[model samples]
Target: MERGDFTDLPGLGKPLEDLGPAEQGHDPDWWLKRLVEREKITVLPPALQLRRDDAALDDHLDRLGGEAEVRRELTEFNDRVRRVLYSTHGGPPVTTPPRDVEEEVRRWRARREERRARRTAALAAREPEAPPPSRRGRWWPFGRTGAAGPSDG
Candidate 1:
């Protein structure tokens, strides 16, 4: 779907669609870092002053645990901010509708249950008891012979 379509969604609002081409090349990781930094600047509290100092921000973004931690923090902050904005603006939550797709799911579940019940009932009805073997005739591995013993021609 187009960026506008995603933005028009009830709760999605306006998510960043483009992070711009990297200076060197179209590096996804570089774009991700830029996006994360931008999101942090926009969503996080200025009063907290987490990245206020340029040196501190660079150090924090470059430490051993920096990339993963920064990405995670940015993601969480963005989600919370989005949720608050959507709720304030009367946008729907991200949850799926119970009636929309659920009706078909419920119908499928019911049909599956009914089929299982029918199969169980059919199996019970068709169950056969073991019977004793009869010794009326000599049963040979090949076709039956006219006489019980081997032919004495």
Candidate 2:
């Protein structure tokens, strides 16, 4: 206790930060609920999940490789959206329409090209690599091609 090992810890003496629900009055499990929300734990229905995925689909598509892969992902996403749309055992209605595979693929291609162009331009803007130092002058220090210096001449 005398060693002060616990000193300088973050928020050592400060009151705990109040999570939002405390103002609304106490639920015994508020901490648990807050934990779940903070962790982004989703128990959302298929329709809602699909909506979230729809909004971030382009970001997801950019991570995938090749047109075929992008097409496949878009098709799978569309299939899920359609399924939720048609299903009767629903929660919220599926508002996210199926993405157009061709259109998404076109966009993915354009993004890829733009990234490539940026990389190429960045490389072009950098200083040209200096030529490798010549080895010919090293071993033959007397002169290049063993030519005599003025002192020797």
Candidate 3:
């Protein structure tokens, strides 16, 4: 896989000094440090200069932890939704059903309850595992580091 140019990243030329206490998990400075330290890119000058001082870094860590929590919640929600979808309608959903509104409603409610119960049981059987921490972040730094580019200092 070929890495591309850093300038081509989603946000470029902008320094990472804007991180605030509340923006924790989304710390641009932390993200930059991660890339420099983890990705082993030699040419690009480490963006350490942009590191937020004072209380911002602490908030950033808190934000990162919250991100982990959000991910867990999202995964559980997705699993339950998928289970409900698959269980309630084993086959492709009927586009047009009989006009018996009351009967259809009754059947649907029953199926939904059954599917939800099964989902609860299945989810309880196992817990979601978080993956290893990755240095990569919103910034997509790429392409030919240590190439004596202009940013190479």
Candidate 4:
């Protein structure tokens, strides 16, 4: 189906392709109603349902780690789905604008540098100064003080 067709389904705020193939084939209203019915059957407290859903999502994310494209697409899909579902359910919106990644990277680098500095200072504080080498009989092998040359002459 075309992307625009998804708009005909109730509470589906974005294109079908964004939600992954599994959700795209199903009607949004039908899925929402099924979810509601499941909640009713179990009579789970809303908080518990949210916790369970979050745990499932975390497990899925763990499985998807190191899959960069899948991770990015899934994150986008989750954000879109959450916004649509929460809005339809009359809850506070869970959506936020995308972050400024450059700024975030700068902050991360600064924090890393601070941590490195602290570790280096702690190591220096615990370490003792190295002792000087003994010089009584040690001689450079290539210097003019070689033992064989003058003695043989």
Best by lDDT: 2
Cα displacement (angstroms), candidate 4, residue 52, comes to: 15
Task: Compose the digit string of candidate 2's lDDT tens values, residues 44-129.
Answer: 88888998899999998999878888988999998898888888884887789998888888889999999999999999999999
Tens-digit per-residue lDDT, 22-141, candidate 4: 735656587666677778767544334444555454345444424454446455645655555555454444433333434534444565567679999999898687898777533664
Compose the digit string of candidate 3's lDDT tens values, residues 1-110: 16665547766766555455553656647777777878996552112211222124323333333444534543443454445444553444423211233443444456
Q: Residue-pair clashes per candidate, as listed? A: 0, 0, 3, 0
Q: On a 0 to 1 TM-score scale, where does candidate 2 land against the true structure?
A: 0.60
Measured on C-alpha atoms, candidate 1 has an lDDT of 0.48
- Please list all clashing residue pairs in model 2, or write none if there are none: none
User: Which ranges of candidate 2 are over 4 A from the true structure?
Assistant: 1-40, 136-153
lDDT of 1 by residue, 83-139 (tens): 454554433333321122234334445655676799999989995878887755445
Ranked by TM-score from best down, the candidates are 2, 4, 3, 1
Clashing pairs in 3: 24-60, 25-63, 43-146
Candidate 4: C-alpha lDDT: 0.54
Give the Cα lDDT of each candidate. Answer: 0.48, 0.83, 0.47, 0.54
* Top candidate, metric TM-score: 2
